[model samples]
Target: MNPDKTLAMVPADTLVVLDFETTGLSPNMGDRAIEIGAVKLERGQVIDRFSQLMNPGFRVSRFIEDYTGISNAMLAEAPSCAEVMSQFAQFIDGCNLVAHNASFDKRFLDAELDYIGSGYSGEFVCSLLVARRLYPEAPSHKLGELVAYKNLTHDGVFHRALADSEMTAQLWLAMLADTQKPQLSFAQIHKLSKTPKAKVPLYLSTL
Candidate 1:
């Protein structure tokens, strides 16, 4: 779906907070997503979730396994990336997406979707970029660090898809409140994230 046609129907707060635990850094270099996790948020509440481990048809590097706690044993019985993403495509239907470092997720999402001849209609907002504008003084904008800085609830899990997506969801909500700009449209926030930090206040004020 074209973002223009759907943006009007989709509210910024009604979105899927998504995360992908992958085999390595670049999908272009043949990396693949080992797991996909997401939470559907409607009006500030988590209404649904999607989680799955996808076998990439190869063993994950020891560093990747250690970093994400997703081992070869875990991927051995999982479905293929195409199968999992087909289901995920439905899960995120007609909803905008959010992620901590959205560029990374977007790359994998596009590449995986390309393999299935599918794609997302909704645009994505980067919580990391939004947080940079909203919490410039925070110790760091990394998901875990921002969660700690903002006092968002968590189970002390990181790198795993579901845990990270949940933290990102909480952080997104917090930033919404911090904006103090009620009922702002999704496009406004999207633009704000891309705006320079020093100009964020001014950009939002004009919106």
Candidate 2:
């Protein structure tokens, strides 16, 4: 998984949507990612998504197996993190990331890249923050719950990166429509990336 190999597959400046299924939470606590998915968006549309299962170089926990339905046997034949992350980073070059919980995905991704001798300081937008602000009336902000509430059944295979990324992209588009503000500018979103100084009023949703 060389840089040149990745560049040859995807072009620059594409909007890369990302998702991950991990062995556990907190990269700082030794949790490693087991799957990665990235979707390229160009011209405000999804062009393609890259996804692969990864061997996290550790045993899968019983909790992880119960939650994601991915076990050690499933990852025995999967690629390594460096291998899949290389391809993911290639597709994501020069593109802003969109994800449900941006920090969780970004932290692990950054850790993996850093571990592989790559540095990352990319821009990102979080749909979870957006949901907390825009859909205050909804009780749950989790992606799966949102999918069910929105009735957007599209054969999503959870614990797989690509499928989750695709679903997140669709959910974001739907949210834009719901808010009647489809043309939000880059500057506006950049502001969203900032940590708000004061606690703002958030709406309460009925779950």
Candidate 3:
């Protein structure tokens, strides 16, 4: 139950890069997710993908609209997080989840899973952490900034679920190269997440 193992290191196979666009910042404050995107990797290759827009049962902010390009009208036709999380949980089953700022996405996801009478406690790898550990000399650690620093391009427009997920995937590949560690298996990661911690750092997502 060593907290250091949460993401201390990993092997390079069966990773799932995930991203979420939520109605607002605080999941506990009623900010629910409106979109989700995920890409599954096996042995350094992307083998499966998942993307869906969700109805958060609320309105998206003007700022959010401008940022993510996901409108209320677009969400009206989408499924609820409860509906999609079920499938998403399955999609990411037995894989380590990777995200740029993971805590943000994880909090919203954990709350949604709770609401659905389920639990989503899994091992997660933070790209921001990798950035901190590997590129401590970098001026910025924001995903877009990191992408630019790495000289990578976002194939799809930014902010959308699938596009963001794809960017996360590429970012993960770059991180793998930077960290020089193989991807970890689900068993190894889950044990790390479940272990108790004395002082959990303010996760990258919150920053």
Q: Least lDDT summed over 10 consecutive residues: which range in candidate 3? A: 198-207
Candidate lDDT (C-alpha), each: 0.90, 0.72, 0.72
Q: Provide TM-scores for the models.
A: 0.96, 0.81, 0.80
lDDT of 1 by residue, 112-188 (tens): 99999998788889999999999899988889999999988899999999989988988998899888876877788
Task: For model 3, name the residue pairs that clash.
Answer: 11-182, 11-183, 11-184, 12-182, 12-183
Task: Write model 2 residue lDDT over 91-193, tens digit each, in one string.
Answer: 7765667788999998898998987887544467787876666666777989987877777766967767778888887777676556443454433443433
* lDDT, candidate 3, 128-171, per-residue tens: 76566556667898887788888888764788877877887787
Instruction: List clash counts for every candidate, in order.
Output: 0, 3, 5
Candidate topping lDDT? 1
Please give the distance, in angstroms, between residue 50's alpha carbon in candidate 1 and its true position after superposition: 0.3
Q: How close is candidate 2 to the true structure, as a TM-score?
A: 0.81
Give the lowest summed-lDDT range of ten residues in model 2: 198-207
